[model samples]
Target: MDTSDVAETLDHLVADATDHHYSPYTRFDWVDELDEQQWWMTPDLLSVAGTRHARELDEKQLMRLSKWEAVNFFSLNIHGIRELLIEVTRRIHTPGFELPSEFFHRFLGEENGHMWFFAQFCLRYGDKIYPDKSLPVTTTEEDTDVAHFLVFARILVFEELVDHFNLRMGRDATLHPLIREVNQVHHDDEWRHIIMGRKLVGLLYEPLRERGDQDLRDRLDLYLRRYITASVQSLYNPSVYRDAGIAEPFAFREELLKDPARTAYHETFFKRITGFLSSQEIISGSPFEGSRV
Candidate 1:
């Protein structure tokens, strides 16, 4: 968290970003349509996976659900990228952000490209992108450093969660080739983002930690834990279920969210991010530990 150390990391990240940049428009060969018969997402990554609910669906119905889940996943990326872009934009070139602003330019461009491709996939294949339904994180912290720390912490958590899906789906051969390609591309970009976010979040929190603001830390931890929970919950959209032709969409969603198997999946999925937050002393433990919905 030294000033020189932060500057050096940003320098290397900025260089990497510059050397690896690509045009999103020409990056992939778009087919007229994605095959409806193939899995758009890995079966194990689906919302209903690991539960009795998955047993009720026939293969064709499960494939249909996968398609909607894939769409929902891309839509979530679009919305998440937009939120992080806004937060980063507010900080770039501003006071206290001088060190990371150069990399922020690269971050902004890459994220915008990401939003474009994710939207393209959702629109061309699914006919519509799902709307963002999760509420924004609201905080009572009046300290500038606290506010800044929260912004980067939220960004880090978001990227880590998205990368969980990206890393798995990108390598999953059961998914369609285009699905794999998109995920692979995203996974590649997200590594840089995640690394940068972690470094920045740690640096941002250092000042607060030095002040021994245990009360403030506790409050921030609660806010971020709820944010993580809300983020995961957004995937269980009733609209997604309805679009998949599932009966009693709301009731089905409610049941699935409370399922023990689903809770286990959530814990496994969230392990890395929660561990990282705990390492930073940002949170005492995993939010999904013994958590329901």
Candidate 2:
């Protein structure tokens, strides 16, 4: 309810933090044991799954696509975790944090471990992490508090998007053992991170409300929706399609993105967050308008 209630929840989280910690080192076998022909993502979850274009691909192509799709997915995680580490770690010993800092320390440790394992996968197999193509723009604002609120809110938006992937991929049996284990470990850690994010974002939003800042509201709404679209779109890498030998990868990406089935799948990707953001009056219901492209 209140920020204090949020802190209380975090206190409980901090108390239980040690119990949830996993050593990325000991838990997974890092050998080159993956079958290149095996899938790294679920076939049903593939970008082109429900499209008529599905008929064009043979079994070998599907496996090849899933292989790189996995690389793309894990590379995105590596990028995301690094971004979060920058945000969370910088906030840890700062003035405002009184109760959550201890938990944040624990959080930072877990995230660092996640970065290591995720990068290991990308580097070991793909030999390169996907460089982030979009540069983030930071706007200077007079209201530092409002800015702080937006930063944390943006973090929540990003976390929840990845949370959907982790929730599914962790349990998807068709994926390779290493990928599944990575997904599950990250999922376990992210449960606490998402809890912290929802609480923190709600607490920060009240200040903007008190200031009667519709401009800021509109700005955040736009950012959140755009970020969601970008996150979902990353899952459908053009390189994955091209490498799979799909013709005209860019044109195919455009077609698949607009496909009704893919559009609906995009909706499902943001389903949990869409309702919550709408209920919070933080954004319009389904701001991506079920077209999360």
Candidate 3:
């Protein structure tokens, strides 16, 4: 799609946003307190790795796991949103993207608001957020712009995967009312974000492929793989392990990584993402070939 098509798509997205916009401050009754005894994991979604493992723990262990997992998830969202906002803001005012600039401005405002509320939740209850960890870098001298594009593309891929879950969880009335509302609000905005990202990534990929830079393609695949791998690692909660009386949280992480169920789930998530890239022709079939680190 060309610039005009993108601008049109964005206009539709903006209209959709207007239809779905929600204010957490007003929509959710913050005065209705959540009981500590309630499980944060909705019954229908209890099969998630962390939730399944959490069931094996005692009350103290479950509480620690809940707090750590909540912080970890929120922290990742904060970091990811910040990075994407920077990228969008840098390009919004640049020449040649005038038509879609207005949509991007709205996107940045919505994401910034998301980052603020997520960070606020972490700080209010968790006391502190999780530390920032850099994703593995995969780049080469030739066609550096392709490398940068791939970084954001990989991020978009992850966001889409999470959005799939959020979309489902949001509509489930059986879930905790507050959790459902949060997911509903997030998914509403994310639908527009994912559409914009897919269009932008496709636009960026054509020139890179035209250059026929094998090294650039290789680096792109490496970045994609590293992003998916690290996303799985994000699910590991060292604090949970510590509370469960497991010594050497790192070793426990390693053990959990080896578990067949966990491994399969991780692969399932990445496979869905990689499948999208492959279908889009952004990455060839030989992804992550001859990459080490």
Candidate 2 residue pairs in clash (backbone atoms < 3 Å): none
**Per-candidate alpha-carbon RMSD to the true structure:** 1.2, 2.0, 3.8
* Tens-digit lDDT track of model 2 for 1-293: 35679878898888777876768778788877577798888777788888886777888888888888778877888788888889777787787766678888888888888889888888888777877654464556567776777677767777777778888988988777778888888888888888888778777777777778788789878877776777777777777777777889989888887787787777787887777778888887675564536
lDDT of 1 by residue, 117-182 (tens): 999999999999999987766777688998899888888888888899999999999988889999
Q: Score candidate 2 by lDDT.
A: 0.78
Give the range where candidate 1 is weakest over 10 consecutive residues by summed lDDT.
133-142
The per-model lDDT (C-alpha) reads 0.89, 0.78, 0.64
Residue 232, candidate 3: Cα error in Å is 1.7
Rank by TM-score (best first):
1, 2, 3
lDDT of 2 at 148: 72
Q: After superposition, how far is residue 12 of candidate 2 from its true place, in Å?
A: 1.5
Which candidate, 1 or 2, would have the higher TM-score against the true structure? 1
- Per residue, candidate 3 scores C-alpha lDDT tens digits across 1-293 of 34778777889987877766666445545423444454444432222364345456566555445545555667778877877787677777666457667777778778887787777666765667777664544455465566547656966876876676567668877546766666677787887888877877777777787888888677676666666666666666666456436678877676666655554455454565577788876666433333211
Q: Which candidate leads the pack in lDDT?
A: 1
